[model samples]
Target: MPHSLPPAAPLRGRFDRFLILGAVCLAGFVLPLNFTGPPIATPAIAAELGGSPAALTWMTNAFMLAFGSCLMAAGALADGVGRKRVFGIGIAAFGVASSLLAFVPDLFWLNVLRVVQGVAAAAALSGGNAALAQEFHGAARLRAFSLLGTTFGIGLAFGPSLAGWLTQTHGWRSIFLSSVVVATAATVFGLPRMRESRDPAAAGIDVPGSLAFTAMLAAFTAGVLEAPARGWGHPLVLAALIGSGLLLALFVRIEQRSRRPMLDLALFRYPRFIGAQLLPIGTGFCYLVLIVLLPARLIGVEGYGALQAGLLMIALSLPMLVVPFVGAVASHRVPPGVLCSGGLLLAAAGLVWLGRADPGAGWIAPLLLIGIGAAVPWGLMDGLAISVVPKERAGMAAGIFGASRVSGEGVTIALASAALATFLGAGLQAALPGHAGRVAEIAQHLGIGDLAQARALLAPTLDPATLIGVYERAFGHLVDALAAATTVTAVLVLSLFGGASAHDIANTHEAPAARADGRPERVADCGAHG
Candidate 1:
């Protein structure tokens, strides 16, 4: 059945508007809080659960995979049914999952509950953004989206420190328990007042397209994530990669034919839209990956306690809180392409700076620069992408945009893990120049999170200077690789923006001639952005 539009009520007051943003934005807070929190809590979780470093990695992945997978479909459902209904369900579901996670009997159960949490987060994000797009128009839309971005940053900024403190003092389970309380309260208060809005004309979700895309992302991530431990050439890894390729091809075909595709392949026809999509991937790789990796590096390599490392990361996260508002305000004056491309290049510069930064000087400066740079695109791109679509499909567009983000995060981590593993293996070889057989054993031991072993593992044969150089070079290689990837991504995004029209730059949904069908015609002279 088609969605029935809610009767337009009187113009809400300032308090009501604030509450609307809070209702949605508060839900937005759930994801980053849980996702980044785990890196800080990993040691405690693993110690209690008796798992390895790889197992700890899955604690993040299990949630990410499910979140990315359900996002597109959830968006479609929200568009067809109603944003408030889906948003309420998402909050209740996440609250339930978080409560379950608080008492999870083992690591396996914790991971399982994370998937449920991801699904709930997906619905909440899509429904919240869709509601904002529906309720606010023109300049108010920009401000509303900015607030949404700001709320998202707040979640990211606090996740590490809070998780660290809670895990250190109250225990790892406190992190989840806290969320249970917050989410339950938010659902009780926020959901009731969240006015229902959705795309009345939207066809039901394209099941085949959604499943194929999910399969493609899942297989690809599985291949990349596991390749570090299993080897790229391992039968399982190769099979996964091959399956990902096949699934990707099938997804394209399905979308091309489906009347109501979850992801309209034609949206890529707009260079700005493509840039909008790719921009997030770079941001995710540069920003969120930093959120996870820096904590691990500080706590593991530098020998800082979890709490100390988390506190230090505040330098990196604080700028994220302010930059979104700056970018949102700047978007009115500057082109989306310019803001996005500039943000991407700035972030890449920060990555390169961090890649080469002297350990003695500390990461605070480079981390600060990275936060400022990432905030521009992170703050602006969602509004930019959704601007390319029609208002009715805002929920669906939001879903696709978010799916790209979470997918990028998962893929980047997987790639980073692979590169890190490769770098570590090479470091072992470099430290013990003549000992080929010992390298594999030493690498395996290091994978379990013992940083003291760099010198100790190779002590009898290698000197202190050699041991230190090995680690320095290994970390440098990982950082440099990420920097290179970001630079390349930025250049491509810039090129896309260079060729886009004014319409693409303004707001994707407002672009003229768009229809309910998934197909988009070749856009020539689609008006200029100004």
Candidate 2:
């Protein structure tokens, strides 16, 4: 039988939850910094390399796809091999990859390095939560999760600023170098004190299941990301989608029967868990749409430099720093459903407001609302997700939640890119009405300097002001679409809260003794020998 050890004792004495928080927070800093840093230099990088417009996106998407697909395996590995060991390995890999990225000669090599970096990130992110869940349970667990959420918020909040400063002072290569330094520091600080948490007997890594799931994720993500460039009907795109579906079916079948599955499908039985998963997906879709588009719009359409755009974008992260503590305090007194639903609603409202922001509007006010709105949902979602799962399976739960958020963001970006392209093409046609035909003709000529010649042909008649207006309108339309999606998420979260409110209230009123031990003691059963 799986060991049924009591939940780990709440941190007592000098070494408490705070130490664990600091250690894990150090590991958390590298991810958002690496992920968002590249995008801040997209225009510069593209210009310098003479790369395709779409090439810039791969810097971020490559990482997201690899990170999302590998998280499940990372979680299971942590369970079998030990969280600290897995974390150290991941941190080391990330540091090496980051160092390599600093010296990459071209975009292709950079993408290759990014994929490696993503795998390393998966190991750290997946294991961090698992280790925390194992080390701290009950109220202490809640506090630990809140701190993790805050750390993430802080990273996102400051990452762009850091990237902007680095890119300005030392160029884009500096961003990768920064990652190397941070990852190296985390490895050094974390390795000595980090404890092992995997319960070996219950934590068998399902290699076949992991492989199938990875194929499914990779195929589906590739289809989604490439669909904008290659129409959805294209053969390769269609094959990827079909293959993903089939592989996913196979993964489910394998997991259902596996002696020890990588995913704990049983957790979905809880409404809270289901809501937590879906809400993040919805919120992620909105969040990525805004974060990706805002900087591009500022830099490309508004003619702001990379640093200016990045500073404006910092609004997205600021609230992330403050909101989680609010959520943490509320978590102690209020039901998570209320906090989550309210946060989603706030985010929806902010997106709608942002959708209507004038192109020339003063930046501070709009950005402040956007920052606060984003922070609240981000702050609450992860903690709420972890709260719904039992301690033994927290790693699996965290992996699934993180994966869902990333997948949603990836799909959203693909769809948004297609929409923007269609809109921009139409706008360009309007802006260059008289020269449109000539521009198209030149574009298709395939002669030397064809693109430059086409630009020359269209340049005289293309009204810059009108073109900017069109792009802004299209951006607004995209933001509106994001707002709609966020609103739908808000409604779903509210409905969940309504449905579960009574049960939570009942639990709240239970005597202290009954409620104090409401969570079951199942740590030993988690495949850990100890």
Candidate 3:
């Protein structure tokens, strides 16, 4: 059934607009909080649930995979149905899922509930954002989105400390319960006052494209996450990796054939657009992968409690709160190519510094440096994504960028985790040559900061200090690889951005009709900073 806009009078009222922004921001806040909090609690959850390494990884990956995969589809649904309605349903569903998660009996159910929460998160994020777009225009829209971004940053920055306190004080489950409260508040405050609006001409959901994309992401992430335990040569792991490629090919074909495709494939023809896509992938490897890995290492390997681990994480995440504004401002004076590539180069250096630093006390400076580097491009990428395409196709640009950012984060984190686990497993095998078969299981435990469990599983004679040393060495190797990957990405992005010429900049500003072919004539240049 189609929905139409409600009365303009109520929506125009200042109070209603405030309520709408507040509600949307609240939802935005919870999503990242939920995302970042779980990794901090992974050790606690493991201590009780006693899950396999793959299961532990799924606890986080399942939510991210579902969240990233469903985002575009959720946006389409919100547009077709009522944005307000979709937002309400999403927030309500998120609350229900979160409440259930607080009491989840095992890791299986925890991951199952997380998937539900992720779908809810997708609905809430897309619906709320779309609704906000309707509620505000021009300057107000920019300010509203800015606040929304800040709200998300605050949550991402502070989630670890808050969740750590909760985990230590109440239990790991309290973290979910807290989200339930926030979700309820969002629904109650925003839904009733918000005006209902829908795009009457919105395209129907692209089921084939959606399924293929989601499956591809899930299959690839699952294969990576499972590889540490199952081995890269395992038939299922090989099948999954191979199937992901096949799914990708099918997805491209489906998108090409669709009448109103979810993704606009034509955009990829532009080099600038391709470079814009690389921004998130670079940050994913350099920044997001660390967010998941660092907390576990601090608590389990470094002997910090959950609270201490969370406090330490603030060094890494705190810069996200302010450095993005620096990036935004620097875009004016510094060439965006310089700013972006420089930021990434800084991050690469920081990663190397971090890998060499002593385990616990020597981390803060490098963590802050990495965060600052990542934040520089983080703020610019969204605006850059929109500006790279024609104004008429801005929505498509946003959707594509959004999908790439989130999905790339999930895939990169999974790949890095798998590599780290494999490295750790190899170290364990070398040390305990007699029990080679159990190396993967021990690596799994050690990976999540369950050092006690890992110690128990291995030979009784191996000292705790020796095991910690092995884990640290493996982690350092992983960090070194991530740094190298980020550096390569930075070079490629710089080269791509360097290709832009003054003529291309002028072409991006020209009206579509100005071109002979009726398409945006050329890719954008650094003027994308605008």
Tens-place lDDT per residue, model 2, 1-530, is 33443455454434644555566777677786777667767766766665545456677788977887788888778766777788888888988999998888898898888999998999988888787777765666656776777776677567777877788789989898888887777766556666666654444567888789778877876676566446679999899999999998999899878756676665555455566776666656556566665666666556677787777777776777777787667655766666666776677777777767665456556667656666666766676666554555666666777777665666666667666655555555666667554533322211111223234455655445655565667666777777787778777766655434322422322111111222222211111011
Q: What is the Cα-based lDDT of residue 438 in candidate 3?
A: 85
Best by TM-score: 1
The TM-score values for the models, in the order shown, are: 0.91, 0.86, 0.89
Off by over 4 Å in 2: 4-17, 360-363, 426-461, 499-530
Error of 2 at 131 (Å): 1.6
Per-candidate count of clashing residue pairs (backbone under 3 Å): 11, 6, 0
**Model 1, range 207-289, lDDT digits (tens) per residue?**
88878888898899878867765678999999999999999999889877877777877667666667778886887767877
Best by lDDT: 3
Question: Candidate 1: how many backbone clashes?
Answer: 11
- Error in Å for residue 94 of model 3: 1.0
RMSD of 1: 3.2
Pairs with backbone N, CA or C atoms under 3 Å apart (clashes), candidate 2: 3-525, 199-527, 199-528, 200-527, 200-528, 202-527
Ranking by TM-score: 1, 3, 2
